[model samples]
Target: MSQNGLRFTLDVDGLTPAATAVARFTLYQNLSTPFLLTVDIASDRSGLTAVSFLEKNATLTLWQGNTPLRYLHGIITGMETGENNHWQMNYSLTISPPLWRCGLRQNFRIFQQQDIRAISTTLLTENGVTDWVPSFYEAHPPREFCVQYGETDLAFLTRLWAEEGIFFFDWFHPTGPDQKLVLCDDVAGVSTLGSLPFNPNTREVSTECISELHYRAQVRPSSVENQDYTFKTPGWPGYFSHHATNLNGQRTQYEIFDYPGRFKDEQHGQDFARYLAEGFRHDAETAACASNSPKLWPGKRFTLTGHPSLTLNREWQVTGSVLKGEQPQAQHGHRGEGTTLSNRLDVIPADRTWRSSPLP
Candidate 1:
């Protein structure tokens, strides 16, 4: 008869109080990517008249408690209308961070004499995200590379950060009501991380069947086809070349990236070369599982039990997660019964060197 914990609040830029039609909204949270809120309004559309007031930089917020958790503010991108019947009107709005818009724009021009951190910080600031912060595992010095012309910002970020073993994500502040940007790195004993003090023992699993777990791994041992290789900097002529070695077998594919700048000397080349060699230390792994109990986050480790094979079970670190919850049809505008937070997480083997340090 009541929807106690399934309530949410939506605050638009100009709106005095955040808005939410209790039984009409569903929230979706994914790793690193922004959270999504889908609001369906039936019949009268007077409540959402503010949709016309939304502008490009307008902010849209989704929250549960006075304090935000696993949820943050999203920017208004679009809206649509649907007709369930002549008298019933259906309206929907899409909200997410400005990243979705800015990420799509092509790089205006090539950058010069800039480091990776510099570029990343600039991009973050320019997109209206002034509070960009990196965890300690991200201590590596700014890397130098020549970016090509006409590339999208998101593409550049994915390519550059991947090589450096870093990722981009957003999380709400523990103390404040704002979403903070995290430039994370996958380094063991170097980045900030904390243990889950709440459930010290193995958390309950949502899916009991052993078939619920999925795993895939690709590894290539050191071999001729997978050996190291070198590439000369485009404009530098014979002065410098970046070399990268594959710790696995011969590579079936290869790519040569040109950052926006040039290496000042051979030492720079050597450092980049070492980066190339160590970049692929971990095998490409894909695994996922569903859980209705323990909530998961990206870059954190968890354990699994009851796998038929020993090799298939152990401590696994989460790489991504999708948190979902649903309730029965509305009773006086409230969802009931099914709102306990259903979640699915993608995980990988916890390689020692890839674990993050204690969290701040």
Candidate 2:
């Protein structure tokens, strides 16, 4: 294996390479967003004729020690190939989850008396997505009517999820390329990873650890005030507001106000108000870290240790990550050449609940 004890194998349409043959790869992952995996490979011939890989299934398996640590499964959505030299051909491929196809088509549709969960499930099912789980704690009252309105399935679904404060992330399987889509509205649904030490001096540590970390905080509104009108109760305009606790610092009193909050009654208005308030404060505080740990993916929690600031040594949840790996040119044909795994992670306090901001 490589110096970082990381290796990977890429299988495209049942055609597994003898070695990973991967020169470089970048995996972009984030909560509420579909992942994109791009990998460059050195092959013996052009993939265009050897294999009809486009739109075919693909999986990238990451290995640590003798065990598989992570699996990225998706469809080969894009590809480019060219001759690198007389001995080998170079190609690159883009892999994305089946859910990504939802954005490829737009339509107009309507539903009556359905909740967000039920509506979203239907959209996912219609797009041929079957492996998904719901982790919601709040009640989703059925709406009288819902409309897709000439938007892509992803666009419509995103709007619905944002309104209900629900988001999703993928969970990689340990043994195969099968990943699960976990839809969550609460932090309890987030998975956790054991603690890792913060060792700034990368050369001094042998085990997987964070080499660099930084804490950040920004000002955001502490409360949300909203009002809506309904024909059934024309005389009474629905009004509701929600506030965050202990955000009494500088500029923290700033308030957000909205008219016609898109709800019919006071109960729904209150819920939307809370969702808006939480959405505003979602990124008020965050942490940025770089690590060699392959387990630090979005929608997962981890604890930090050995930090100069004691307050930084606490539980945090990853909100997004950029994972990069590369192998030296000399080891291209090896079964498992070493891959230098470096990752940049965006995280927030584990105690804070995550909410997707309303899309404009």
Candidate 3:
């Protein structure tokens, strides 16, 4: 009759401590995208009668026994109050990472002699983000010139990262109560979450197991080819292309071609072409699953076992997840065992190379 390990706590900055609990929550986390956490709160006091008095940021924490499962700290982008009856009032808030603030403003700026990493760092730091790490397996040469072109900071960063096969995810700080953004250009940068078992019996499995799963394979473009023009090499045609070798003869004749590859040299063009090709092949072989795991998120790898198919009983990395949890409405509240958690996860094989799709 107790949910001792399934308690969710929310603390708003500058808001006096009162009776507040997460009645329900939906958290969306994906690669190369900012995380969004929307929580329905039950509170005893309506001290935040008006949005004007609400704090700018808050910390949402989930606990399992004596250990904290996750600590999501973000800016309070939105708030809503509803159904104020008696002592308990219901409200909802939309929380997003500090990086989300970049999307609020547009700018026209030029970055000279800076690489993608440098430009990203400058923008992130300007937006008060100091806890970011970049993990690149290869080198990125400084671009002679780059223009923001009336785009928001988030859009600009997204374009640059997509072109360079870079992606980002947030990870909880080991020794702190916050999360740090990690940008990685290689799959090696992703951390592993050990392993979990797949149990089809949702009625009799632990909270950390996958309840249902599906494997997907589709025929996509087998190759990507693109051509770009450089003023320095006016007469020379700048063409580069790459083909996928992991398609296993599934419509290998299919090709993807494009113009204006946006590279300055042959090597750069080839790299971009490879990244584009990999992007198409990324979802060619994937696994979608439903789980009760609270720790699974993007940029992390986990091994799946107990599956009927031997091929699927391997390590996979999460690319996207939609996590939904609801606290039991029983009188026990925080100590109720009826609390439920469900998550839809999208993952790819651990050995496959992952790349962000190019933005239009």
Candidate 4:
């Protein structure tokens, strides 16, 4: 529905973004780092101000009327040339989340009997994060752990939750006013787009809503079983090694890379093993689609009705989205309302809903 409903700004670089007639944008959330947004600009050079010199860490915000779709507090991660198609020069820019910028700060610390929740909160706070909450999922039975010397914020956070089968994701401030670094447990954000189970017995299904979808199933290799993984604290011999059974019925032994953090004991090793197995047991299903649904969003659940190959009525969660569009025709020297809305989405199988619902 973005035929005439998209506005954007990059105040960080003092950019006066007049209507560039030919353009496209891609907005991302939840699943990836730098929860990026891509801007594809195509126009005559005379009407275009050079945005290439925009500082690397400038903020970018996208708006639909007064409502903001993305508030990326990170930086301008990338800027490049796209194509000089049909006498038009195409250029692109990318914006990332704060997490990506966190890498510039590195630390070596120790935590003794600390709650993972509290640990994360303190780190987030020191990192300038405010306003946040969590769902009810315990990553491990043990409450404490320690990170080794010289670890980046992103690496530490990702590793800590990954061992517990939790994918740490950032959430946006829904109303577009409050600025906070929200870390979600497993889902996308504070939205109801696909936050529930696909109950086939009830609920009306929307048909032909998706214009394009690329779906795939993936399996982990049996070679992972060729090694054993371990985690240990000081004065301990390390927890039991995790074993993986190959398809031929023989257990393959492999090594889990050294963990920078210290685990309490063998019990924690068992938990880690379980996480590894769970990763192996599940066959990965991924979806990337293009749709015009402005309401379609990440971390929300919805159903599909008219696709031939895709499973009909199955619960799908948006892992991420790229809200993009451009003016169909070139407004060469002057600016006008030529921007439209086209969204690109990444989705997966969803199990449940979020704690705080989003505006429908």
RMSD of each: 7.3, 2.6, 2.5, 8.0
User: For residues 1-360, could you state the per-residue lDDT of candidate 2 as single tens digits?
Assistant: 124556767877755484236777899998899999998877765444535667888887777767787878999888887555666667778889989999987999998888888998899999998999888987778877788999999999988888888888998765767788888988888988878989887766767787778898888888999998878878986889998864637465689998878777666788889999998888888888999777789889988999989999999999999999876562334454446778899998998778887676
Q: What order do you get sorting by lDDT, best first? A: 2, 3, 4, 1
Q: Write the per-residue lDDT of candidate 4 for residues 183-274, one digit (tens) a residue.
A: 45454443555322222222142321566667876554332211233444345555444444433343344344434223455556565554
lDDT of 2 at 60: 77
Give the candidate order by descending TM-score.
2, 3, 1, 4
The lDDT of each candidate is 0.49, 0.81, 0.81, 0.54
Residue 290 of model 3, lDDT score: 87
Candidate 1 structure quality by residue, lDDT tens digits, 261-356: 234544444444334433443335557766543235564565566566657667676666665444334223434564444457776666532321
Q: How close is candidate 2 to the true structure, as a TM-score?
A: 0.93
- Which candidate would rank higher by TM-score, 2 or 4? 2
In candidate 2, stretches whose alpha carbon ends up further than 4 angstroms from where it belongs are 1-5, 18-20, 47-51, 246-248, 330-338
